[model samples]
Target: MSFIPRRPPRHLLRLLVLLAVAALLYFYSAPVFNAAARSLIRVDAPAPADVVIALGGDARCMRERRAAEIFNRGLARHVIVSGVPYAWGVHTGDAAKRYVESLGVPAERITVLRDAWNTRREAMDVNELMRAQGWNRAILVTSPFHSRRAHYTFRRYAAEYTFISMPLEPEPPEWQPERWWSRRGDLGITVREYLSWINTLAGGWR
Candidate 1:
């Protein structure tokens, strides 16, 4: 009787190498991606402010609803719905304001600015309004992915007042925060947001 050693299969070796590469990629990339996502989202609105600002572009009205909630909680004396017209020519700012008003916010306490076609312009418009109204701070509401860029843009334009950014939670079908890399749409969103942030830092907000 003779004892013989068996060689490992080539497929098994290939699989092990692939797994090592995957683990390395995950270890290096996951933290950076998660950091970017976390940085974009600001959940704490611990203090009150002069007004609640619902940023434009989100037709889902998620931010508007959050702003309404903040207003209901007496975190702000006013709500400024900021956005331009949507694809169907409906003024988003007015639409958001109407929605908030229907939620029990007083009409007088809500201001609709339909001239802000983009985030930079919205920041400028809100900044001017804040100056005119002598508002010292604002509770800024926006999507979780957009909050960081929105904060940067607003701060660039309105450095005089404080902006407490409140980001809406990532909703399913549009975003998956826990498994953000599982969908192409989420990857696109994450990349776009990061690029936008970079562009803002590069003076694109000007």
Candidate 2:
């Protein structure tokens, strides 16, 4: 064969492609991810929803309680709280399960799913439960800032569930963050939500 000089290495081309993808992932998904997260963080009541399905803990005990108040007033007849009182006992679902039942939701009207280990797990559990029960419409209950991620994840996984957003209003000035732009959380909740929002926008989640 005639002496042929080696072609330029394809490594450079691969690097360029990698950089391009990174840039796109950051540019497109970053803003949307953050913006959507903030929207979730700031939304106390962006709109109406059917059932304020509490995400457990303070979200259920406090802010979500407000939303549940509306539900108790006949806004919706069904509310689903995902937790297993009989299994994990009080740590996960027991308190919430009792709380909802105390809200006048007859045992039959309230559906308790007690198996979620995290919000994503809870979302998936609730999704499956809703489908099984044929519950097509719902309003997810989580902290004001967390509502976005929870709502988004639940909506994404469930796919067919019709949902309205109802966030728990952040506590008064005492607990409020120093700035309006502060992310949402109770000890790591804000950070966790921020990451989750990012994952969803990028469509890179498992």
Candidate 3:
């Protein structure tokens, strides 16, 4: 007696293929997500501007350092530090001003705006300051993750002046984007940045 062999079910074949694909993705998705995480960074070329504004929340003082560098390079004539009070009630704008000053930025060249509690408020207040000062162009300095949103918010709120986005290059080890997912803090920052982007797109923080 001869026995007939039956073919495997189509659903089983499809499931096998899906499993193979999933395995491949699971093994090789690092670069893909790394690139996705890097997409949040937007650094524009440094250009001569009337002023360089460093947004607040930089405990590491990286943003202030960049502002001072830009000023020292003559890319901007003035440096504006914009931020609200810190946890200890010390104004971030004031702290940033001192940081940049210590970095060799002259005291006469620094202006501090302490009323901005968030990026949106920063943009508004900075724009008003620029308008009053007759400044028509600005360079924005911020951390890598915050650059894109900061630039977008500033441009949205302050449409009259030209704004350039410059994220801190060669970011500190703690904020490295090459493997942001490996560290809990970096991962949280990346996720929060995207969420902030959504908020920015939806008319920004109220």
Candidate 4:
């Protein structure tokens, strides 16, 4: 009897193929995902605007700091802190304005729009303020992950004046898209932002 080497079974071959494909996907497609995640963020400090708007929701005060920095740099003489009072028993705009003031921005230069419940509402409030104040341009500040949706919503609602979307410094755990899939928290943030971005594109933000 002649001994013959048997070929791998078809089922085993199929399993091996799937494993190879998964490995390839994980290794080769990671950079693409990272680039996509980063694309949702935009940080542009344009020429001085009429006002700086810090869209509140950052418990870390990053947005307020950025707005203050911009104000101190002479980018804008006025800063408007925009958000509703959902936490801390104080209007979000008020809290943000206080923080900015603490950072050396003059209180008189600080304005608060405390009626915004969401991005759309913030856009509405900002637009009304701009028209009332005869302002022509604004710098919109928010967390990096939220920059895209915020920019989209604001542009959609405030079409008259120029709105520059400024994303804060990308801190880890909240803005790390490259390592997003490795951690549940980062992944959740990335996914949530993507969903909100899609909603904004679909005109669903009410």
Candidate 5:
């Protein structure tokens, strides 16, 4: 048998400590997942925007709910549903329309865009729609956690369009995470966002 030299006592202790920290990070990130998802998914009334924008993912639920609310409030004459569909069946647009219909928004008032491939695509698509259709302003609907990223992405894509956030605060916290820096998963999101920001700074490519 090959003589595998044993690790030193101090090294072994450090190894064990790292294992424990890895475990803590794994479990600790779940709370971040909860925080991000919880902050992102919401059910609420829509704020006033010339056009209502719903981003992809769980925010769809918020979009649908807010769409109906805004329609009823007469805040905006048009609602734009962004995101593409998967083969799994219900596309975001269809789902959004069904949701708004439940709230009594006429079919004519809702416009669904299954072609929006991403956040950048949605912003570009909506801006194009604004030019062709004469929509001067718009309300962007998304979850609270995502509001900042979504806004930055959209603002970059549609510089001419006036943007207003209609974020649905599902579990709006009284205070944000105090030790957020120690939270690795939270950092994961921020890191990803920072990388994106850096990429934008380099070229600002869509």
Candidate 6:
């Protein structure tokens, strides 16, 4: 007598398909997630402005470098470096000023604001500076991951002036947005920026 073979149960077949789909997503989701992460960045086209403000936090000085490039291009008449003191006691604002000046921006054209401990304070202080200087348009230079929130915060605090965001593009090798999750430092930066953005959206910008 010949034995008949039975097909697998419907529930078991469905479970197997679900597991396969989950595994596929787990392995192939990085690129999709990276694109989603990158959506937070906002870079405006280069345009003439009264001043370029470089928000400090980068030990690599990427923000200052971008500010200098904008100044050298004659897009901005002045450069403002805003930062708090570093852990070692040197004010990042002062350091940024020196760095930008070295890149051919005249020392007389650079102003350093060293008291702002965060982006909100920086916006407030820079607003005061812009008011005193009679500057109506400004460009904000910061890390790519920080551009969106930085622009939002500045607009919220300094609505009187036109603020353009110019995040560092072609980001440095150490902070490439693509495959950010593969590096610990890049992952931390990405995560922190997202959290900060959420906080900003929640009116937590203090």
Best by lDDT: 6
Q: For residues 30-125, could you state the per-residue lDDT of candidate 4 as single tens digits?
A: 898889888888777678899998886777778889899989999997998866767667676777888889999999999888776778888988
Better of 5 and 6 by TM-score: 6
Clashes of each: 0, 6, 0, 0, 1, 0
Q: What lDDT does candidate 2 reach at residue 198?
A: 78
**lDDT measured at residue 173 in model 3 versus the true structure, 0 to 100:** 52
* Cα misplacement distance, residue 180 of candidate 4 (Å): 1.7
Candidate 6: give the clashing pairs. Answer: none
Q: lDDT per residue, candidate 1, 21-129, as tens digits? A: 9999878877766675777776665589999999887778878888999999989999998777666867777888889999999999999987877788888898889
TM-score per candidate, in order?
0.82, 0.64, 0.90, 0.85, 0.64, 0.86
For residues 67-177, write the lDDT of model 2, one tens digit per residue.
457577776767766554444335446567677677666767766656755667777787777777767777776667666677677877888887676665566621333
Count clashing pairs, candidate 5: 1
lDDT of 1: 0.83
Rank the models by TM-score, top first: 3, 6, 4, 1, 5, 2
Give Cα-based local distance difference scores for all models: 0.83, 0.63, 0.86, 0.83, 0.66, 0.87
Deviating ranges (above 4 Å) for candidate 3? 1-7, 87-89
Cα lDDT tens digits, model 5, 11-48, are: 88999999999999888976865565444323334446
The CA lDDT at 94 in model 5 is: 81
Q: How many backbone clashes does candidate 1 have?
A: 0
Ranking by lDDT: 6, 3, 4, 1, 5, 2
Model 2 ranges off by over 4 Å: 1-37, 42-50, 84-91, 173-189, 199-206
lDDT: the better of candidates 5 and 6: 6
lDDT for each residue of candidate 3 in 75-143, tens digit (9 for 90 to 100): 999999877776786787787888888999989999998887789988999888988999999999888
Candidate 1: give the clashing pairs.
none
